[model samples]
Target: MAHAKVKRLPVVDHVGMLQGIVSRADLLKVFLRDDDEIAEEVRREVVAYLFAAPVSAVRVDVRNGVVTLTGHARDTSLVPMAARLVRAVEGVVDVEFELMRSEGPAEPMAAPANGGENLSRA
Candidate 1:
Protein backbone atom coordinates (compact mmCIF):
# COMPACT_ATOMS: atom_id res chain seq x y z
CA MET A 1 0.00 0.00 0.00
CA ALA A 2 3.04 2.23 0.30
CA HIS A 3 3.47 2.20 -3.47
CA ALA A 4 3.11 5.32 -5.65
CA LYS A 5 2.25 8.75 -4.28
CA VAL A 6 -0.22 7.41 -1.73
CA LYS A 7 0.39 9.61 1.27
CA ARG A 8 0.04 8.00 4.73
CA LEU A 9 -0.21 4.44 3.45
CA PRO A 10 -2.96 2.41 5.11
CA VAL A 11 -0.86 -0.61 5.91
CA VAL A 12 -1.09 -2.94 8.85
CA ASP A 13 1.67 -5.01 10.44
CA HIS A 14 -0.35 -8.01 11.58
CA VAL A 15 2.52 -10.22 12.77
CA GLY A 16 5.42 -7.75 12.77
CA MET A 17 7.51 -9.11 9.89
CA LEU A 18 5.76 -12.50 9.96
CA GLN A 19 3.39 -11.57 7.12
CA GLY A 20 5.96 -9.97 4.89
CA ILE A 21 5.59 -9.38 1.18
CA VAL A 22 4.82 -12.63 -0.66
CA SER A 23 4.35 -11.35 -4.14
CA ARG A 24 5.53 -13.33 -7.16
CA ALA A 25 6.31 -10.12 -9.07
CA ASP A 26 8.49 -8.94 -6.22
CA LEU A 27 10.37 -12.24 -6.30
CA LEU A 28 10.69 -12.05 -10.07
CA LYS A 29 12.22 -8.58 -9.80
CA VAL A 30 15.56 -10.31 -9.20
CA PHE A 31 15.92 -10.90 -12.94
CA LEU A 32 15.58 -7.18 -13.67
CA ARG A 33 19.18 -6.41 -12.80
CA ASP A 34 21.36 -6.02 -15.89
CA ASP A 35 24.06 -8.49 -16.86
CA ASP A 36 26.84 -5.91 -16.62
CA GLU A 37 25.71 -4.94 -13.16
CA ILE A 38 25.61 -8.58 -12.13
CA ALA A 39 29.06 -9.13 -13.57
CA GLU A 40 30.50 -6.21 -11.63
CA GLU A 41 28.87 -7.41 -8.46
CA VAL A 42 30.20 -10.93 -9.00
CA ARG A 43 33.68 -9.62 -9.66
CA ARG A 44 33.65 -7.47 -6.58
CA GLU A 45 31.72 -9.75 -4.25
CA VAL A 46 32.74 -13.26 -5.40
CA VAL A 47 35.83 -13.16 -7.61
CA ALA A 48 37.71 -10.59 -5.54
CA TYR A 49 36.91 -12.53 -2.40
CA LEU A 50 37.71 -16.07 -3.59
CA PHE A 51 40.30 -15.49 -6.29
CA ALA A 52 42.67 -12.58 -5.93
CA ALA A 53 44.47 -11.06 -8.86
CA PRO A 54 47.94 -12.04 -7.71
CA VAL A 55 47.13 -15.73 -7.54
CA SER A 56 44.17 -16.00 -9.87
CA ALA A 57 43.00 -14.36 -13.07
CA VAL A 58 39.39 -15.38 -13.00
CA ARG A 59 37.07 -13.34 -15.19
CA VAL A 60 33.41 -12.67 -14.39
CA ASP A 61 30.94 -12.70 -17.26
CA VAL A 62 27.18 -12.51 -17.02
CA ARG A 63 24.69 -13.18 -19.80
CA ASN A 64 20.93 -13.31 -19.46
CA GLY A 65 21.36 -13.20 -15.68
CA VAL A 66 23.54 -16.33 -15.72
CA VAL A 67 27.00 -15.78 -14.36
CA THR A 68 29.88 -17.55 -16.05
CA LEU A 69 33.25 -17.58 -14.33
CA THR A 70 36.24 -18.27 -16.56
CA GLY A 71 40.02 -18.56 -16.05
CA HIS A 72 42.18 -20.56 -13.66
CA ALA A 73 42.89 -20.11 -10.01
CA ARG A 74 45.78 -21.18 -7.81
CA ASP A 75 43.46 -22.90 -5.36
CA THR A 76 41.19 -24.99 -7.52
CA SER A 77 39.63 -26.57 -4.47
CA LEU A 78 37.81 -23.32 -3.83
CA VAL A 79 35.64 -23.82 -6.92
CA PRO A 80 32.79 -25.18 -4.87
CA MET A 81 32.97 -22.25 -2.52
CA ALA A 82 32.99 -19.88 -5.45
CA ALA A 83 29.96 -21.54 -6.95
CA ARG A 84 28.05 -21.32 -3.69
CA LEU A 85 28.86 -17.66 -3.19
CA VAL A 86 28.18 -16.72 -6.80
CA ARG A 87 24.73 -18.25 -6.66
CA ALA A 88 23.99 -16.23 -3.53
CA VAL A 89 24.30 -12.95 -5.39
CA GLU A 90 21.02 -11.26 -6.20
CA GLY A 91 19.78 -11.41 -9.84
CA VAL A 92 21.75 -14.59 -10.49
CA VAL A 93 19.53 -17.03 -12.38
CA ASP A 94 22.29 -19.64 -12.72
CA VAL A 95 26.04 -20.12 -12.53
CA GLU A 96 28.41 -21.71 -15.06
CA PHE A 97 32.16 -21.90 -14.65
CA GLU A 98 34.97 -22.98 -16.92
CA LEU A 99 37.73 -22.85 -14.37
CA MET A 100 40.83 -25.01 -14.09
CA ARG A 101 43.86 -25.45 -11.91
CA SER A 102 46.59 -22.96 -12.42
CA GLU A 103 49.40 -25.17 -11.20
CA GLY A 104 48.95 -28.44 -9.33
CA PRO A 105 46.22 -31.01 -9.86
CA ALA A 106 42.70 -30.05 -8.95
CA GLU A 107 41.70 -31.60 -5.65
CA PRO A 108 38.16 -32.41 -4.61
CA MET A 109 36.56 -30.17 -2.08
CA ALA A 110 36.24 -31.46 1.45
CA ALA A 111 32.98 -33.18 2.20
CA PRO A 112 30.70 -31.31 4.53
CA ALA A 113 29.80 -32.66 7.93
CA ASN A 114 26.21 -33.14 6.79
CA GLY A 115 27.35 -35.50 4.00
CA GLY A 116 27.33 -32.71 1.42
CA GLU A 117 23.65 -32.87 0.61
CA ASN A 118 23.82 -29.53 -1.22
CA LEU A 119 27.21 -30.08 -2.81
CA SER A 120 27.52 -30.39 -6.59
CA ARG A 121 30.19 -31.83 -8.88
CA ALA A 122 31.90 -28.51 -9.40
Candidate 2:
Protein backbone atom coordinates (compact mmCIF):
# COMPACT_ATOMS: atom_id res chain seq x y z
CA MET A 1 0.00 0.00 0.00
CA ALA A 2 2.78 2.39 0.77
CA HIS A 3 4.56 1.70 -2.51
CA ALA A 4 1.25 1.92 -4.32
CA LYS A 5 0.42 5.21 -2.60
CA VAL A 6 -2.71 3.76 -1.20
CA LYS A 7 -4.17 6.09 1.37
CA ARG A 8 -6.06 3.52 3.42
CA LEU A 9 -5.76 -0.17 4.09
CA PRO A 10 -7.38 -2.79 6.26
CA VAL A 11 -5.50 -4.79 8.84
CA VAL A 12 -6.15 -8.43 9.54
CA ASP A 13 -4.49 -11.34 11.19
CA HIS A 14 -3.71 -14.70 9.61
CA VAL A 15 -7.30 -15.64 10.28
CA GLY A 16 -8.33 -12.64 8.20
CA MET A 17 -10.29 -11.10 11.01
CA LEU A 18 -10.79 -7.44 10.24
CA GLN A 19 -8.85 -5.79 13.04
CA GLY A 20 -8.83 -2.19 11.94
CA ILE A 21 -8.21 0.18 9.10
CA VAL A 22 -5.03 2.15 8.63
CA SER A 23 -4.97 5.30 6.61
CA ARG A 24 -2.23 7.61 5.51
CA ALA A 25 -4.10 10.38 7.23
CA ASP A 26 -4.14 8.36 10.42
CA LEU A 27 -0.42 7.72 10.18
CA LEU A 28 0.24 11.35 9.47
CA LYS A 29 -1.93 12.40 12.34
CA VAL A 30 0.50 10.75 14.70
CA PHE A 31 3.33 12.79 13.28
CA LEU A 32 1.50 16.07 13.07
CA ARG A 33 1.51 18.60 15.90
CA ASP A 34 2.12 22.26 16.58
CA ASP A 35 5.75 23.30 16.45
CA ASP A 36 5.69 24.50 20.03
CA GLU A 37 4.15 21.24 21.19
CA ILE A 38 6.84 19.28 19.42
CA ALA A 39 9.52 21.45 20.98
CA GLU A 40 8.10 20.94 24.43
CA GLU A 41 7.97 17.20 23.97
CA VAL A 42 11.58 17.11 22.82
CA ARG A 43 12.68 19.11 25.80
CA ARG A 44 10.70 17.07 28.27
CA GLU A 45 11.01 13.60 26.83
CA VAL A 46 14.50 13.71 25.33
CA VAL A 47 16.57 16.32 27.04
CA ALA A 48 15.33 15.94 30.55
CA TYR A 49 13.94 12.42 30.75
CA LEU A 50 15.70 10.21 28.23
CA PHE A 51 19.16 11.76 28.16
CA ALA A 52 19.15 13.06 31.72
CA ALA A 53 20.46 16.31 30.39
CA PRO A 54 19.71 19.46 32.26
CA VAL A 55 16.70 21.24 30.91
CA SER A 56 18.91 24.28 30.46
CA ALA A 57 21.74 22.28 28.97
CA VAL A 58 19.96 21.82 25.68
CA ARG A 59 17.72 24.15 23.77
CA VAL A 60 15.00 22.75 21.56
CA ASP A 61 13.36 24.61 18.72
CA VAL A 62 10.68 23.30 16.39
CA ARG A 63 9.71 24.76 13.08
CA ASN A 64 7.45 22.99 10.65
CA GLY A 65 8.10 19.72 12.41
CA VAL A 66 11.84 20.18 12.18
CA VAL A 67 13.73 20.34 15.47
CA THR A 68 16.90 22.29 16.12
CA LEU A 69 18.94 21.58 19.26
CA THR A 70 21.53 24.00 20.50
CA GLY A 71 23.63 24.16 23.65
CA HIS A 72 26.14 21.95 25.45
CA ALA A 73 25.91 18.50 26.93
CA ARG A 74 28.13 17.12 29.66
CA ASP A 75 28.59 13.92 27.74
CA THR A 76 29.36 14.03 24.04
CA SER A 77 27.68 10.69 23.62
CA LEU A 78 24.41 12.29 24.62
CA VAL A 79 24.49 14.41 21.46
CA PRO A 80 23.52 11.55 19.22
CA MET A 81 21.24 10.09 21.87
CA ALA A 82 19.44 13.38 22.12
CA ALA A 83 19.02 13.52 18.37
CA ARG A 84 17.60 10.03 18.29
CA LEU A 85 15.17 10.80 21.07
CA VAL A 86 14.00 13.99 19.40
CA ARG A 87 13.52 12.15 16.15
CA ALA A 88 11.29 9.70 17.95
CA VAL A 89 9.03 12.49 19.05
CA GLU A 90 5.82 12.69 17.08
CA GLY A 91 5.72 15.57 14.58
CA VAL A 92 9.46 15.87 14.34
CA VAL A 93 10.31 16.06 10.66
CA ASP A 94 14.07 16.28 11.26
CA VAL A 95 16.69 17.19 13.84
CA GLU A 96 19.75 19.40 13.78
CA PHE A 97 22.29 19.93 16.51
CA GLU A 98 24.46 22.91 17.30
CA LEU A 99 25.73 21.45 20.51
CA MET A 100 29.16 21.32 22.07
CA ARG A 101 30.54 18.83 24.50
CA SER A 102 31.23 20.19 27.91
CA GLU A 103 34.84 19.66 28.81
CA GLY A 104 35.70 17.68 31.89
CA PRO A 105 38.42 18.52 34.36
CA ALA A 106 41.90 18.75 32.85
CA GLU A 107 44.43 16.15 33.85
CA PRO A 108 47.50 17.32 35.70
CA MET A 109 50.68 17.25 33.64
CA ALA A 110 53.93 15.60 34.83
CA ALA A 111 56.72 18.09 35.39
CA PRO A 112 60.40 17.31 34.94
CA ALA A 113 62.94 18.43 37.52
CA ASN A 114 65.01 19.97 34.68
CA GLY A 115 62.36 22.73 34.42
CA GLY A 116 62.10 22.20 30.67
CA GLU A 117 59.39 23.99 28.72
CA ASN A 118 56.04 22.23 28.87
CA LEU A 119 55.41 21.45 25.23
CA SER A 120 51.98 20.09 26.14
CA ARG A 121 50.84 23.52 27.31
CA ALA A 122 50.59 24.86 23.80
TM-score of each: 0.66, 0.66
Off by over 4 Å in 2: 1-7, 12-18, 50-54, 105-122
Residue 93 local lDDT, model 2: 85
lDDT of each: 0.70, 0.69
Score residue 9 of candidate 2 by CA lDDT. 91
- Candidate 2 C-alpha lDDT tens digits along 22-114: 988888885668999888766655666533435586688888998998887666665666666677777778999887876673223223333
Show the colliding residue pairs in model 2.
Answer: none
lDDT of 1 by residue, 1-122 (tens): 24563333233486554444445456568999999988987776667656664324788889899998888887877788888877877788999989876886433433344343323323
Q: lDDT: which candidate is best?
A: 1
Least accurate stretch of 10 residues (summed lDDT) in model 2?
A: 113-122
